[model samples]
Target: MNIRLHAGTLLFAVASFLMPTVLHADVFSPTMSYSYADGVALSPDVSYQFNEGIGLSPVVSYQYYEWPGDGVLQLSSSPRVSYLFYSYLGPTPALPTAFSTTSLPPTNMVARPRVPSGTQFLVYTSGAFASGVPLDTNKMTIVLTHGWMSSSDAWPKDMANVLTSQGFGATANIVAWDWRVNANLSAGLEISAARTPSEGEALGGELLYLLGANYNKPIHFMGHSLGTMVNCRAADFIHGDAKNSPGKIPGSTLKLNPQNTHMTMFDEAGAVGVANALSLVTYMLFLPTSGDTGDLINNFWTKVIPDHSAWIDNYISEVGRLHHEAANVLLWRRFAVPVISDISSGLHAYSYDWYSNTVAAPLISAIGHRFSFERNTLSPLPPSGTYFLQSADLIDSPFVVTPLDAATANSLSSGRALVYPTLQAYNGLNVAGNAYLNGLNAAGNVYLDGIQHAGDFLYDVTEWVLSDFNGQSAYVGTGTAGSTPAYMIPAGSAPLQFFWDLPFTLQKSTASPLALNGANGPIIHPADAGPDITNNTAVYVWLPVIVPSNTVGMSFEFKIVGAGTNEYMTMGVSNENYFTMESKFLDDGVWMSSGVIEISKYAGKQTQLFFSMNGDSGLPDGKLSVRGIQFLTVAPPTLNISVNGNQAVLSWPVITTGWQLEQTDALSSSNQWTDVTNAPGVLDYENTVTNVLNSGARFYRLKK
Candidate 1:
């Protein structure tokens, strides 16, 4: 076969395998131009011919084109020859010491200042890395692998910068992997699915050659989606009997440690398989995409970490309704194709941007508790566990997910979980031909949506399991076989939650709740002498307040659950507290929201926040749990303003509920603010209210 290399177009970042999207134009079909065959709308020049000579084999002639439609690749009757002949994992373009983290802003802390190199600075960039740079054996090496149709310029480049910023670059060598030809999004998802081994071999072959030249260094391989499988194959090749290189690193000699990759923080993964995965629409929209190679991994690849790396840290999002970011139409069609099922995306959900943001700012929880990943580097293996986390609301939650131990993972088998016949991992000494859970990969059962043939052996080339469950397939009871009843369907369960996020956070005061509650997180006492004293019916105490100098949308916010008529909480700065805000916080704790208190009112001029309550000390309905709490920073709630005709409209997201609109004639430290009487109503996923345009300067906000 002949090949031609052309000057390719630069790429950008997306949640998954992304095709070109007409962001600023209409999506119209070019009628007389072409039509879709199966899922691909092929180029007019792409022609096929069968050889009249010898065996009369079919031949294809084609060149890459900038097509406007979707479906670049397709699933073939037979799998393509898997190799690095075309696909490869290459290095990044020569980077100036500086990187961009505009998409993911890092928190600047005095105690731990962010340098030019840190994981928080990760973002996508275009172009290729310069060649001929020698590997520095003495430095720490990090290899970022991309999934499916994505190029190195996307997540790999972005994440590399993030790692560099977190002090890893001071003594590190970073590289991003590129495998565009194999998994071209325009071609189709199957193309990417079939390319891992070939690219993995390519990466392994390159690393073997580079390391064999006496270039000894500690290497960390990080891949997202299909890239994870690429890493496994690469690791296997490096450790395998390759002609030139026998054992370099990330092989039998090294243990892999990864955080925020495909793995979630949940350790009881095998407990229910993908049956109990997160059903949150927010995560389903992004983290779980076509490139998430998790569904494709057989029993053999799952053991890669145990045999090769140190430890793996899976930080994934769990069950929730509220979306942190709005959904984009760009996710329709091509981007929506799942490798397994609609549930597959939710199973191993995580985003490259989310991973890079871990080392950035921290968030505050309801009742005023702070939560942040708060780490510097990825070296010195992180603790292993599946930790479920939440950070979408105004306030954040203070909970962590844990992973199961390695020793237990290999031997444990649940009736609810589909496992190998040996009751252990496939990579164990027990031999096997095929061991899928009979009906585990069936049409309607396994793949519930998207690519119906994704895991079926009939169409998808890599599908190794038989088509039928157990009833009458020529194959054995792989998915539906065994000593007991057919594990026909999943015993599904609901997602677990231990979080409560309000809208804002600060860095003032420390959490010193009463003795009975606990010593760790911020806690308020039922009968507090701390921030809320029980001396009389009138009680008040101070909390933290900070407005970042650089970013906008800064606000002082919190939520009190039970504050009712019996106990009302009052918020004020230095000399002013509004009657309107007190009323919002007085609805028997059922109705409460102070929205956003204008931060520009008092900047370096020293502004303080004190909460006062009018009522008895021991009222169970009062918000006494957050009495002596301090603060931190997460993204505060947002109130969008737009002009429609002569009217100015105010709106906030549906995720952030109970935020009351308030109008202040002058946003000042001594200004008296009043509530916007016309109650706002939900429309098109936003709480919207129309107000007549004011000729004078008037400020409005939504506080919870």
Candidate 2:
């Protein structure tokens, strides 16, 4: 997400926004342009502060240019000024140092800390699916998979560093897969899990060939969105080889138990298979939602209007309704011609033409799509610019029968595309997959590609990341082909271990009632709380989305079940905004209801709930639990320390790492610190330098 500022001079601080401050423009003015696609928009090109992590652009206005008689025409425009969170993690960039609880801005934490040259590799997992760095014999590999429309760059840098850091004596080897050419968005994108099983058998065969006995060692697999599917499919392939042809995988394949693996499902959003593999997974679900492909199409229509003018609106309403009913001949015609015709669309067009030409193409390409049609055709469509144009035109055009209005076009063009809630569902599925593999026990059912395709196999890639690669038991069940197996399917079980408690089942639609009678006091809903729930016990609230610093539509409401007079409970966020519930302690068991509260917003961000108690002990007894906690992304902490005179100073951002410090008296020469004594309170340099000669300029920075 990008934010624009009209003023030329601006100072972005950590407390203000979640994402790193990326100053895209050096000089700001009134007129600016933004390019909106899929779920996000790009601001006008400027001297961006990539290292700084904060983005500064001008607030742009949008309007459609229509022909004199044509009341409505398609147009593209930019978004107004708003604070945005740039990452699925914290808004700020990842820090280069070790983990900490300190709250520092991401922009100021980009200092590249010195890494030991003799760092070994044991903690990280290496990648074999997509192209990556050559594996070293001595280093442990950390394999990472990119999600739909995502790349290696998207992998949290901090995670990579953590994975690579030595725990005991193991050195880490980080491997990033660049599968763009293999899984092009619009092209014949291969579903990691192929239905026939033999379709990806070649890749599978090669994987076993490379792994051989090495498969015994645990290989950490990290993926997002579609990448989760890829990881699961790969595991299935390996599983099939072990079951069907043991010798094909080398060593004792079944002996490699998938349960012994250690997986960490962090910020995943994908399929139900993740939940199914609960027994063998360890998941740290960040933010999750639920959904499918057909739901995706409907969501876009519901949220984004293709046509705004009366004519287009009427036509679209009619056509779209017919299309839904499968009653429109034109809809079928478009589908058949584009999907079935061999003469018109080329091979690449048949597969990928949807990307280059349309505004929607870019959007879809930037994110990701599953079960695309281009891969199945015998004579695939060749690359054609028109196909892209046609696809984009289709997006801009209403399904019914109307031309687009200026506002409608502007909506499409505005680069500030907010992520649809349904997208979170998709993300949730992926997260579930990682959790399932990691033994994190997710909540959801398993669905492949959001489509019920036969033969799409699901594998547990986390097993590879968390298992002991040397000599480990493979199969959980005894061989049943020749004799009775030790383990049998449980009654009424739906793919045990593969599916765990998904959010669909974990979250309750009906909330628990507040205590009408208790010492904690009365509770009420935000609506009944009058102006605030600060004085009562309240819980269970719904927030649509996290807002930017300037967006107007930020609001929150909840119910408070306790009394407002004496002891009370309130809901709110903490310093970092990790959800927290505050309440007053009570001695006697008497409770009063304070009702619910609704808050507009501060700094344009939604107002969180809080409960305050009066007639009670001043201290809280940690009895409150807030369900549905939301957190904005935070930048990583990178501290650069240098000695000036007798004082130590530090500075860092997202990009530029190196820095120079000046001495108190003679600022002439400077020395570099390759190692750092990173302890509590102080950031000490790795090297020791005495103040022999006075220097002119002395600075320390993170090496890029």
Candidate 3:
């Protein structure tokens, strides 16, 4: 049931560094073309020989270079990511321990410090880039950033050796961003994470120096643990390159993706025009050694990841109590990206070693089938799927390839254990052509069914909801019987972050509740609607936002910017991340409100505010805008009065939060209101209080 986003109608299951948004942007993942020169595509050096066998070079021979460290490049201006970098790493001098986007430098290159540190760049040349020498722009470039408490000798070098040995060394320039100074702390995990952005941004500057602003060669970014976010920030800081090449990340060098509602689905919720939205790298692969820090950081970077790269993949290895987890970057986008349980591997701290083994021989073994880039996607571009790997630790290479079907005894695809959104949202659970929930979005189904997921658990040390989706259960929060509730699917549940700062523009809407359901009916809904007449077959992509307390309604706008003939599109809003709850849809009008939304039913709940576009036409690359989201306090329950002979009975619908039944004389400023002495009794969802009539002119009112 999980179908993450990418170019066209969905944003990839990307990492947004600040917070995880349920947005799947449409991306154009292009195949890469490398530029190679000379016969030296044989060996990046003798180092990678044991890892991979393929080599790149015109001469088909191996050449080794004395890639020296701590050298200055001839580039003008210094790295602008930081004011000054220490000889090693620690809390950046002037930056805050918490994330603040404004605190970041603006230039594609931040102002470089006068002096640099051991945290320098390592290029793939015999000698470092001294004054005037640049990298071979013709060759493809790959950069590796390591995680906290790590250095170049660990997985970064292992990664470097494998990539080169995998036969790509000829047209490849592998660079290692050795940043042990800032990250060399065993007990300072939090401190190192705070330094991620600046460190990553600094790497962006170094990349510009190595590749130049307009370097057109293909680029790949690899990071482990905290390094994943570092790589994302670097890509965010890259500019001119993204703008120049359609095949390359435009938002990366050209510019970041336009102001996007990051956590929403595919295209316009209301419908906004998006020309070229790609992720940060040709391929941005994330690998975390253990903890949930990777999930939180990656969640924060989803904003940057979706707009910069053509393809994105996260190799998750569950090392309980070891390091970090690149868990849900692609999962909650309704993309069935699995949170591979390394515990499934029955090993500890061996995820790094095993994954490095995959990079060296990706498609040759059981585990390789999981980590291999050679996946089968319907699209012709580089394959994209959360590696569905299951096995015990590796020996030399990928050993065991156990698919989901083996464990569950179900004949599902690699990760198709439970379907999300459900076959229900696709009109019915058991569609005719669907091989279970395999391809729920064929013309037969028109939407993604759920797939295998680890369910919902708060994992990251920072406390981000592992899936960034918030809600208690797939079932609606009320007792009303649902005739066709598709209770059988992989469910993505609630949002109660564990610890990381909630750094967002948080404001609760004070508007009145609408009556789509009840003023207080549960808001969990599987949002989808059809215009019976025209049959607009458009793929609707919804953005998941946290509707603050009292948010009763929202205003949005959508337009069919460009589409094939007879293509029609509509927008919808929902309270669930995957839009599987009851929802509001706007089929007409340029500017309007999804008039049926109600939030009072589930107070104290963290639910999604989604904008989705669905139609029956060709892929409508439309523009959608959601604005004026307003929250309303629950209106006082209706106060009713009935005279039973001598006594007067007063009643109102029961309020979950205690309320007072007060009586006042006259409705003026000077009127004194007092609580009724008599206690009320509840009957049939209403509270009733009886009292004798008084002679004075008295008025009744309700108060907290």
Q: Rate the local accuracy (lDDT) of all candidates.
A: 0.32, 0.24, 0.33
Q: Give me the candidate number with maximum TM-score.
A: 3
Which order, best to worst by lDDT? 3, 1, 2
Q: Lowest summed lDDT over 10 consecutive residues: which window, candidate 3?
A: 273-282
Off by over 4 Å in 1: 1-128, 213-216, 241-306, 317-350, 360-387, 391-394, 397-474, 477-704
> Candidate 3: deviation at residue 407, Å?
12
- Candidate 1 yields a Cα-based lDDT of 0.32
lDDT of 3 by residue, 416-464 (tens): 1112121111211111110011011122121122211111101001111
Model 1 lDDT tens row, 557-599: 2334444533444444444442112222122322122212322
By lDDT, the better pick of 1 and 3 is: 3
lDDT of 2 by residue, 523-590 (tens): 32211121212332222222122232322111121222333323333323211121111121122222
Best by lDDT: 3
Q: Estimate each model's TM-score.
A: 0.31, 0.21, 0.32
For each of the candidates, the C-alpha root-mean-square deviation to the true structure, in angstroms, is 31.3, 33.6, 29.6
lDDT of 3 at 485: 12
Mark the regions of model 3 whose C-alpha exceeds 4 Å error after superposition.
1-119, 125-133, 185-187, 239-306, 319-349, 366-387, 392-398, 405-704
Alpha carbon deviation, residue 111, candidate 2 (Å): 48
